[model samples]
Target chain A: MTLAAASHGFLSPTGVEIAFVLVGIATLGAALMTVGSRQLVHAALWLVVALGGIAVEYLLLTAEFIAWVQVLIYVGSVVVLLLFGLMLTKAPIGPSPDADSGNRWVALTVAGAAAAALVWVVVDAFRATWIDLDGAAQGSAEAAGRSLFRFWVLPFEALSVLLLAALVGAVALSRRGGGAKGAAETLAPAAREGRL
Target chain B: MHLAYPAVLAVLLFCTGLYGVLARRNAILVLMSVELMLNAVNLNLVAFDVWLRDTLHAGQALTLFTIAVAAAEIGIGLAIVLLVYRNRGSSDIDRLRDLAERPSGPDGAGSADAPRQPQPDTGAEATA
Candidate 1:
């Protein structure tokens, strides 16, 4: 890894590296807005930008299939679901003063510390490593499909089962009668009749 | 491309999510932050997969699985947030302190009494 990285000097960046850095900066900015914005709806919108930027990053990385999946799943569905949740919960359209918790300063301090430490470690460790993107794309749809069906069949099937379980669990948890108050109310008549 | 770029980006995004999780009041916003964190992991996986060029392409495959699992997670998480909103008429995480230990009073009221009461006293309780 060090040898490969030594061949490719850090001062001279290729076009791909420049693009990746630019998009990454945009993504990071959008992410910061997503977490820091006072308007709830705008926060979700910023999340869309951030996730979309990540999809672009995947494309630049030559993971074509993963890029599309990221677009479809995250940019397409997740943000919409989040928007629906915000609306259903009656989140204020304008900025709300209490968008952040009281311990936000503490949270900021912790996150800053973590970011600084992790960034230092990752940069130092991977400084000598470089990815060779000159060859054919590694994550095209055909390659991904062949590997998925051939090598990763069992995990794929298991993931389907997990999805099904999640579906049922979500339904069960969201139902009206699942709450403690509802259960207590239902059992009140039984206790009144001395069935116990 | 230098591997440090993606690695560093992932770290920053994950920490941003961490901050959001700890600081955000709304449960849905917190869920969005979780998505950010998961996406960061996906970026790292793809970058490493491209670099390694393994025959099995384990990194990309796992990335797909992670995406699927994240989808399921968001579904379940949204359902839970909706349920909490339905029951309590609010989805602010800080106010949902049903499990938080409180100082004992002379009334001998159990923690069970906390969640059942209305949200009016939440601010006072948080201040105390």
Candidate 2:
């Protein structure tokens, strides 16, 4: 089996590469659908699909740890938070005229220009670069953790502090309205009613 | 797989997200757009992390940090947007223009820029 694998064509595309292309196309399509969906709920659902596709893309790239993290953080938590935000804001679940403004064309033009520039720069800079998938350091969680704790500890700690601040800020911002305070005050009665 | 394939896909996703950010009026949708862009950046980071064969995997480390920061930012942004929605009746970014400096008016209310003061009880807002 090892001999057969080694004797495989050096220049021909492999199954992994084919799977990568398929997943990439799906992810890109879902991303566009996420932005273009007319219904707010549908947009959120499309976001889930897009995020999940990206997670699969990460897996194909051999970053198993990050792929799972993407699934956990992005697909699980972020989308749920977005749904909570939508509910809290009383956003219409159906099609919303306010989902988009009148500047779609202008925005599309700018986005196209930016994407073109980035692709051109990246292609020009790394045209000759290739990664060896057989290497150990590319995506193993053990190596990632070692490197993270060794040299990137400060930034990692700072990230924790930033998350703490954001927690405080979210609480403060959402606690300002008096009616919500009333709801909190009535929580006991509401719970009692739910018992019935 | 060609690194350009993933890189190109990331760029397309990023561009789509940018369009959403610029074109969407709902604050929550705009936040989702921001998330899309962040995911694109993460894809690029991991791709380059592999391409460079860095023992430290600094790009993946940065991607993790970006994820954490994105989560934090969305939490705070959602809180603010929900507050605005409660105080006013809408979460339109166009309606948030009153966050700019508003001079005082004769009615002891804010200046004409923010024509309505945000009164939480009555939903008559003095602020945007």
Candidate 1 lDDT by residue in tens digits, A92-143: 9999989999999999999999998997788778877889998788889999
Which pairs clash in model 2? B116-B125, B116-B126, B117-B125, B117-B126, B118-B125, B118-B126, B118-B127
lDDT of 1 at B120: 46
Question: For residues A1-196, what per-residue lDDT tens digits would candidate 2 score against the true structure?
Answer: 1111233336476787768778877888888888888888789989999999999988888888889889999999999999877776656777877678889889988998998787777665645455567656366678778888998999999999999999988998866445554333344223324643
Which parts of model 1 have CA positions greater than 4 angstroms off?
A: A1-10, A178-196, B104-128
lDDT of 1 at A98: 97
Q: Residue B76 CA error for candidate 2 (Å)?
A: 0.6
Q: Give me the overall lDDT of model 1.
A: 0.85
Q: Which window of 10 residues has the lowest lDDT sum in candidate 2 chain A? A: A1-10
Specify the highest-DockQ model's number. 1
- Judge the docking of candidate 2 as incorrect, acceptable, medium or high: acceptable
Per-candidate interface C-alpha RMSD? 5.3, 5.2
